[model samples]
Target: MASIEKHGPSWRVIWRYQGQKQRTTWATLDVAEEAKAIVEGYRGNRTAEQVYIDMGVLTPEVPVPTTPTYREWAEKWLGSKTRISPGSRARYKQQFRDHIFPTFGDTPIGDITTIAVGTWVNDLRAVMGSPKTVTRYYSAMFAPMKAAADQGIIPVNPCKATDFKRDQRADDDTGEHKAVYFTPHQFEQLRAAFPERWRVLLDTLVETGVRWGEVTALAKMHLVAPTKRTAARVRVWRAWKRGEGGQRYLGTTKGRAKRSLPIGRDLYDALAALVDGQPDDTLIFRRADGRELDYSDMYNDVWMPSLIAARRCATHPPAPRGEQLAGATGRCRDYGGTRDSGEPCGARVRPGTTRCPSHYGPARNAVSMCGCDGVLVIDQPASWHDLRHTCAAWLFSDPRMTPLMISRRLGHATLATTSDIYGDLMPDLEESAVDAIADARKSAQGTRGKGARRKR
Candidate 1:
């Protein structure tokens, strides 16, 4: 039995169990009444102590652990990732601060539901407008929640329960381009676009398929000069990486795996020339000042400029509507384009435009060609990683190179990873496979016919 009585500044709920009286205090009459009702409801079958625990008046013998908030648990999860690279740690921190924390930081891990995760993903897609970026951010957030579920802190991982595959299918239906890699001829044009000093760097990238970090971190010691009986080899053991505060440092390769890549004699000689007379520890590809190569400086100052120069597009000054204009050539007029120097934009404008595509705005085509030189315009831009893809593309073109061999050459973690990425680029290999099957079937049929004739 239970009852409530008004006390000074507080209300008291009283109950009797095992012939003893017990009481609990509440701040409000409503809470007091509710506590009384809870105790009364459970008094029939449950013991007094159990009723007291249900009423929030007493602690149970076995304490239940409190479920941590997403933020708290995520911090624990991050701390547990001792083996992740510095760059990965920085990226995870960024994702937590900028993306994950905003949505579910304060929510209890147990309270995070699949519907909530789906809604967050949809919101991220709408705001970010890049499914790939959304996926990257989501993966950072997913790992923590998954750990929570594994530890039974939550019933299940909401991130995993969310229908990401269905969303990906929807993205595919929207006709997103899956990959970008240049043909050998296109790669040559791009290589020729670079200056003589940086040409070997581009060649190395397209030839070996090493990552930007790996290529930039190359030292003289990594290169093995060509021998009469064996081809030249480059050891990929380290890479330049960013850590906390964006400080650059030498780090292990992406897979933490060391590999040796065979290079052509010409490429080997060129690489050797770059490091000639330098110390064994000196970077093969370095800045004019002998400092490490910075990606932003190289991309904006060198890579993009070279790409535009390769286009060799015709350019014209701004002309009034219906006015016939003579062609003009030179630097972009857009303000603050180069290093915020406030000078005219240095990026080359496409033919018939006053500003470069960056300032001129988006084009409405997958590819555009320069009317003058028939060069592919920069509408479908490629990144440094595309050079790695280009290497894979070239390797896949060779019938002698199996996916497993290509995987080893590319330093991919597994053959499946190689297939997943470059599968679409292997149409010729697929055709060869079909041709081999047909040839085998024909040989089998010929043998059967010969046996029949011998029996006859």
Candidate 2:
């Protein structure tokens, strides 16, 4: 039997098992009654431990271990992640260092309450300056705690109760990171801006939509049927990625999928010419000295200059006071003249052209002939990866191309990935579907009318 007694404002349940007395306190009489029932239920065959279990005070069959500090568990958790890529491991370590350790590292894992986690999340958002960054830090913190909970070191993951919204800005129409692409004509203009030696590389990028790592890893042996004018294909087997400490290494392509993409006649011819006389395993693209292409050098020295020259005019006037006075001295002799505001023209000029695009009429191969230096500045800034975006855009322009086709071409692991990234660029699928249904119905009605007339 069990008994209930009132101690001031609170209620207490009392009971005895064997020879020892047992008791528990509750804030309300209703809870006291429930506790009394649980105490009485264990009277016949069950023990006191069973009664505690029934009262929701003890978990059955499992022993609670000493709780480790958050830092101890996090370190152990990170060390056990042996399968993640080196780059990913480095990023995770950095997150632990910069975000996780400072606040909760030394605290006992069991002491991390939900309220504390929620407060810490708010602090992280304030310090990190963006919802996206806060979310990443939160994930890093949550992972270790979750592992601890799973292993029975903690009762529950406090992070699970913390609320944080995923940053949706990337997917919003006005997102700062929205994908931008160039038209074929614009691509040609950009290609022409590069020196003749580098144009083939640009062609491969725009045509194949392979990642930069895959492009850099392309070898002569990867090209199959190199002499075929229209049906040549490039096999993507591996990719080059820079590991931690800036060491370059070869690895599986993203999603670990190997795929082949067909090359156009122009690209095939270009590749055939480039690979002529080279060893089968030699890289198709390299520096002038035949060393492996350094991505940083390529972007800074080659890509940026070409992009600037292709998109802008040299409106920048010569140095005002120094040797830049037109024909006054050495390197400044060819500086373009003054701007409309009488300021020295600061716009960059084409290599051989005397004036910036603003002053010059048009380059021989200029696409729009608008002679507007503002175009490049106003358009979405281009990055190396945007070449992939350009390829997707061109593929989407064709009404016959499907998302699955684009996904295969891009070597993506799933159709959903392709659709999620490039769904906006796809032709109006709903409209096309409705139109096809209407056309089918119309054809059926015409066939029935003809049948009725024949019957008549």
Candidate 3:
């Protein structure tokens, strides 16, 4: 039974059903009277669903929606990912902010359809202008939705039906999806360009094939020498990586696998000179003022300038117009016919030339033709990681080296990775396999011929 009562200028509806009391306040007596009638009707024998529908709590054709919005679910999912590395967490947060939130944040998890998701993916690809970037953003968006579906919050994952392909231009730019590396001659030229103090660091990078983070984290204690006559080897257990806010910390290597690499005598001697009497934990390489080396600072101040200097053309003739070269800035080295003058030419040289237009011949029409004076001009610039690729290339060039040996040296997680990356460089192995098969067939034929003759 239900009743309406006036309580301090407001009308209240009170009801008793299923042995429980329920009450609600209304501003007017008329509204409270209507609610009291509806509650009184519920006193009769009826299903809970019929009562709920009569009270406008649920529609006859639709059940109550319990699905959370995308934003709510994403927050819950991100909070549960506590085991991820700090860097990865930072990246996920960034991806959510930059890509996922703007589009699907307010949408209900159940309401997100496959067609809507496909449109969103296409929009991201169009706006981001890179398929690789779109792929990453798509993955970030998919993770939370997939989790929702797996937990039964949603019936299906919309992302599971969409297909995204990486941009072909990206693969073409990065050496046809293969690792880009330096040749030995190019490495030597780059080596000579660096200051003597930093040469050992470059040597270590080329010889050891360790990652940039691992090499930067090297300590004196990590080097081991079994005997005085033997070359030392580096034990790689940890690496230094930048986390959120550019904070640096030591962590395990990429594959989470520790490895040891043998160092040549030259490298060992160089390292010994640097850390002879220092503490076992002292860094093997640092700035001139004893500060930790930052990759960006070193690249901008030293690497690019050195590379430019090493590739400058020395024999370029002076311009026909006798105008100063367009990009000239650095110190010139061409002395012309004044070698006996006992002074360097010391004039400002152009960017693509070793000397000013007056000293060197004319600036060549093509940049490739400019650096013909025994200097190698690299068409594509190489990053620090490319040094490791160069090491892999050299190892693959040797017929004696096997994939397992290269995989261990490069610290790859599996032989398949090494084979997939450097498989194109192993063309000779295919030829050898074919020859072996042919030889086996020829030997079987010869044996058959001999047996027939003996029977005869």
Candidate 4:
């Protein structure tokens, strides 16, 4: 015999199982109906209630997991009983807990859809999260769902190839220009603004575009002697933990890291001094006392504070606008202050415009230093890296270099990627005015020939 009754707002179904009353936690009336059918079927069959069989009338197609909840699967995806970086794994857990499972946690993987993900992204974006992050989290959060999809638990992965819109968080906060970085002169000014140790850090970053992690992972072993045909080199073979724990890894780059860069003689001297008398195992970058610095440790304790000390952020004036004082001459003006000074004294800034030309000098922001002297930098708006754009622009303009070769040297993954960044830097050699003038000259020559024939 079984008993059925109502409790609170929803109907509660109770029954006798092994001579004891049992209740179902069907939160809704619709759920209760399906649960009631399952109970009734079991009662009719006289089957024991302890059995763990697939049973759901309404969502019959979705076979019940022994326990259907996101919390169960997420733990498994965090790498069960394995040795991985704490930092990396924490992010995995955070993404699942914060983003994915909350929205679709209760829904069966079988019913997940592209539209569902799209809608969720829209809602999240409305709340002011960056679309780029949403996309990244989508990859990590759905690993289990991917497994479920493979087992026919779901039909498709809606997260792949998604169209994400850029977020306006930075714009909303400070109203900065969309692109920011140093020009050669500004970088020189900012670099000169830095202390010796911090000078090395900023100069390297402006030169290589290396991520903070790669800089920490750098070791004396990475540098090799130069050969006749090739220049001296340093390799980006490892990185400090990008994951949760402070574990160091042998290989992995974050956001444009892990590149083998040619160290010009000037940059090489700075690096060589840092790693002098150290074993191959010792890192190239270090604290003042020569201890290996973790990624965040360097950025917080040293990098940002150094910028503060140098007054880089404080001295920044508004960006330069329109045509700069320098024309096609390519001859730079005398702005004082070196990269190690951090003053706004000697930069080639156009007053009130956002342009800083030095950061993008000949080396592509690789080592865009200026030789100008005396003036202390007052204001800067662009970043130390936007100079890379300035440098990339120069490479594209020269007919002697192809975009492919330039992209390879720049460590861009593809020609298309390089083109996206620096394509417009190359002008159309088509020169309509030149062609029109040539046509006029040819017409004049023809008229002269006709006149001579008439005279003959």
lDDT of each: 0.76, 0.74, 0.73, 0.56
Count steric clashes of candidate 3. 6
Count of clashing pairs, candidate 2: 11
- TM-score of every candidate: 0.71, 0.65, 0.65, 0.54
Better of 1 and 3 by lDDT: 1
How would the candidate models be sorted by TM-score, starting from the highest?
1, 3, 2, 4
Over the stretch 283-394, how does candidate 1's per-residue lDDT look in tens digits?
A: 9999888899999899888887777667654452222212112463444554223324556667765456555555553222212343445464444677778898888888
On the 0 to 100 scale, the lDDT of residue 370 in model 1 is 35
> Judged by lDDT, which candidate is best?
1
Badly placed stretches (over 4 Å) of model 3 are 1-68, 109-118, 142-161, 166-179, 228-231, 317-368, 371-373, 414-456
lDDT-wise, the better of 1 and 2 is: 1
User: What pairs collide in candidate 3?
Assistant: 316-361, 317-361, 317-362, 318-361, 318-362, 328-350
Cα lDDT tens digits, model 2, 313-383, are 55642222222124232121246445656777766553455565555553322333355643343255577
TM-score, model 1 to reference: 0.71
Candidate 3 lDDT over 1-456, as tens digits, reads 677788999988776544556676778998777766765543422234544455566587866556888888888898898656677778888998877888888888876776678788878766876656776788888899999878977756878865544433333543344456788988998898788888988899898888888888888898887577665788888888668776988888877769988888778888878888988888888766665688888777777667665766556522432234565466665423122254666666656655654555433322334656457667677667788888988887888888799899888999887776677777887787899899999989888856454544
> Model 4, 119-204: lDDT tens per residue?
78777767645645655666675566666545554434445424532332323532222444344665566566566666776766
Candidate 2 positional error at 356, Å: 20
Give me the overall lDDT of model 2: 0.74
Ranked by lDDT from best down, the candidates are: 1, 2, 3, 4
Residues forming the 10-long window of minimal summed lDDT in candidate 4? 360-369
Query: Between candidates 1 and 4, which one is better according to TM-score?
Result: 1
